[model samples]
Target: MRAILLIDDHAMFREGLVLALTQAAPDFTVHAVSNGSEAIAELEAHSGISVVMMDYYLPDVGGSALLRRLRQARPGIHILVLSASEDPDDVHAALSAGAQGFIHKSASSKTLLEALHGVIEGKQIVPDTYAAIDTNGRRLPQSDDAALLSALTPRQIEVLRLVCDGLRNSEISARLGTSEKTVKAHMTAILAGLGVINRTQAVLIARRAGLFGKPN
Candidate 1:
């Protein structure tokens, strides 16, 4: 069984997630805490926890700082940020601070499960829509720079578009009727062709290049 810890300031939200996670995976051992301090205590008390799901806003500490502290304390445990904000900077900050993934609170239950599983498997996860938002939460305007777009194959463009639509690799695979490995291959090519290091950056570049029809 997998041991998971959830940290959020709101009792209602934390309870709701507990129920949702229990329904999604019955074998998961979940512990919930309402603040960063309590979360640290919970971590100290539970040595078997494999993952920590945290909200970006906490009453006692900022999410990113707390994440950094947790990473320093327990480098092996995977930490995932669950935030309601769709700001690209927030996503970038959390991941840069050592979070394994950033999950929108609005994600469907199935998507949430997939994200947790992906993180447990040592994968970095970010919502596809992060590409559409600038640091100030404004949609990036389309650019006339077709140089990057022209370099990509049609199939890679297709994958990139779906990535902008906020689909995970597994979801993209189902949509394209391909295996996840094939989707990963396409992503690798897309990253190299775009000259970006990660999917989020690739999507942002594609959006700026007007590769996608409209910004979400």
Candidate 2:
């Protein structure tokens, strides 16, 4: 049997989801909780839980921190975060902290189920908005671009531009005449300087800061 542990503070919505999930998947055993503490206790009590479906905002704990705690408790558990926020930072932070998928609360129930199934099957799921931003690469003001890019060193900027071009780390290393390890180190600094948690977010912020080109 597939088991799901859901953590959300809203009582009506949480109960509704539990009912909906059980009806949709007869083989699923869904357990519901309201906060971080209860979630921890439920997870500890139920060793068979395969998926954790949680709200990104909690009254008691921050999203990334709770995600980290859950991951530490169960290394192999699959986690999916649901939120009303479409913020790229939130999406990247959840993924960076260990969530396999992030779904906005505005999504249809069908979409949410599909994401859950995908995560359970070992797939990483990101929203269509993020995909669009990644593909289009929009530009912002020149001053803003200069200021954000200024945080990165010349080498870091070079590495980031290559990443924006979709080059793999190994390919970047070859192009820059550096080891893959060094490229990875540069990437870490780039992410920190850009205030993002992953390459996708880094690219989006770069585009927003006009790193790619002048505004269209």
Candidate 3:
């Protein structure tokens, strides 16, 4: 039997998901936990766990941080982020943090099951909205673009521009005449400043804020 772990803070939502998954795949075992710590404990105790479905918000640790920790601790386990947020940035951050897939909480049971199955089959799943952003490489700025841009430093903005252009850390460092370590530092700060968790999210947020200037 396949085993899956779910981590989310809301008891009602978690219980509902557990019930839905249990009914959908009766042969498979589903376990639910309410926080990162409990999720970690469950993972450690259950060696049969093959996939982890987690929420982007946890009471104990941020989603990205928890995702990173799970990746490091169980390198072979597949993780799928199930979040209520439909924000492109949140989806990108979950994927960047090593989640195999990202699905909105509002997704239908069929879609949710498909995502879980896809992750178990070694596929990366992203919602259509996020996929569109990835394909377009830019988005129109929202009304709050100015406020978001103001939070980032000029150097951080430069780093973010390269990131939006799909440059890796090494390439970014070379282009800026800086070390890769410095580039990473800039990325970290950029994520923090933008209230994002990863490069893809930062790029998405920047693009939507008109930081890339009409994509041409």
Candidate 3 structure quality by residue, lDDT tens digits, 142-187:
4575587788888988887766544568767988999999999998
RMSD of 1: 9.6
Candidate 3 collision pairs: none
Candidate 3 segments whose C-alpha is farther than 4 A from its true place: 134-216
Per-residue lDDT for 199 in model 2?
A: 79
Flag regions of model 1 displaced more than 4 Å: 131-216
Best by TM-score: 2
Estimate candidate 2's alpha-carbon lDDT, on a 0 to 1 scale.
Answer: 0.78
lDDT of 2 at 33: 96
Per-model C-alpha lDDT, please?
0.78, 0.78, 0.77
Query: 110, model 1: CA deviation in Å?
Result: 1.0
Locate the minimum summed-lDDT window of 10 residues in model 2.
134-143
Cα error of candidate 1 at position 195, Å: 6.0
User: Candidate 2 — which residues are off by over 4 angstroms?
Assistant: 134-216
Q: Model 1: which ten-residue window has the lowest total lDDT?
A: 207-216
Please give each candidate's TM-score: 0.64, 0.65, 0.64
